[model samples]
Target: MCRGQTAQKSKRAKPYLDAENAEKMGEHLRSDYRDAVDFGGETGLRPGELCGLHANYVDRERGWMWVREVLVARRRVIRSFPKDEDVRAVPLTPKAIEILDRQLKGRNLTHGCGLEHTDGTECASALVFLSKRGRPMRPDGVGACVRLASKKAEVPAVSLYATRRGFATRAAEGGLDVFALADVMGHGDIRQSREYVQQTPTVRARVIAALGQAPPLTVIHGAAGASLGADRDQQPPSETGIEANENAC
Candidate 1:
């Protein structure tokens, strides 16, 4: 008896929220969750990383953030750690800066969560995101919120992690280096990050456009076929035999 399992080919791409769907989802989410969703999509951070984000991680002046820690999500319980035991900095774009500003605008709100430190401790603050009850946010809660918003937005159902995936895909499409993307995403394996650079409709369309830039080729199909742009002297006679009749005349 053969005692082996068959290996399957890896999927070229994973499903992710596109810009339009993300916007629509944002529109349907509650204000609190909307910002969280939008931020997750923009930064490509894991759900735990987003939930654990602290004000200190953001650098408004420099337009970048240090990803120092992440919230660990288990079944019905939450923990803390730095994802993959690695700390890295991710640069922010103008749009990301705008979103960060919006989050900071209401920092004084009584109902917000805090950060889970890498040392297995929780730090309380007017965190970037918080639960309605003023407690640290959890992945399950965020996931539930995403589901409802996607339904209301009438977009394809995608998980909260899809927001992160969307960010990676968009960044890759924007020509960001794959190795850099891996660092930004906190991926331990570069190959894991490469999966996000899968071929999409937009990428395919761009490829076609690029191929069209090549010079056009001309071909003669048959012995009597006229060459493209051929001069009168090199032209083939028409099927009507007009050239022969004219010569006879």
Candidate 2:
């Protein structure tokens, strides 16, 4: 077991669930926070950003969600800045949009969490995920719920941060480059975003397969192949059924 200084010097812990396992974990969670779990798995938003999500920032028609602010759990405050202090837009999959749609129908936008915009207009947009008392959710509460659900689902135990890692992994699998993944993750440094992506066996296999030394047999018998080699090289155009066009430039 790594302890003390050794633990500190070891690779930073990065836990994540693949897409399928993440869905299974969501299945075991109670209805109260189930959507939150699903959303996290899909969007890869930070816990504070998830808790701070507002209806106004969601553009269902465009299929995008803007990360404008975060719920500062420790301070018990709503701040108009993400962890990197940079606002970013994250694309939504159809499944993610579905989760948001359901939450939109059930939430009372006139009340609940509120945020003060920078333009001197104090908007009282309701948070997407809220507590029983209609306040912003804390990270501790969210993490506890994730652990309970993971145990029930019989999947690997993963923290809420794992959802972010999962999203990064899924994105990488879908062919997103490191720089683009960094932007979507709201990461200030590309290196931090690179840490989120995990290489899977399937990806490794593909890389190896691309190095094959020979082409498929079908290619050798095809038009291009038939035109190549011995007799064909000495054959006249007429014998090969190849004709020259008089109109050619």
Highest-lDDT candidate: 2
In candidate 2, residue 231 scores what lDDT? 31
Tens-place lDDT per residue, model 2, 1-249, is 433334323365445766776778888775647778778878989877888788888888999989987765544456787244598999999998888877778667866355444434576777777554454555556666676677777776777777777788778877788899988998888878765454533454565568863433221000111111223233232211111111111
Q: Give the Cα error of residue 193 in candidate 1, in Å.
A: 2.0
Candidates' lDDT values, in order?
Answer: 0.63, 0.65
- All models, RMSD in angstroms: 24.7, 25.0
Candidate 2 lowest-lDDT run of ten? 219-228
TM-score of each: 0.68, 0.71
Best by TM-score: 2
Q: Where's the lowest-lDDT run of ten residues in candidate 1? A: 219-228
Q: On a 0 to 100 scale, what is the lDDT of residue 197 in model 2? A: 52
Misplaced by over 4 Å in model 1 are 1-10, 73-85, 106-126, 206-249
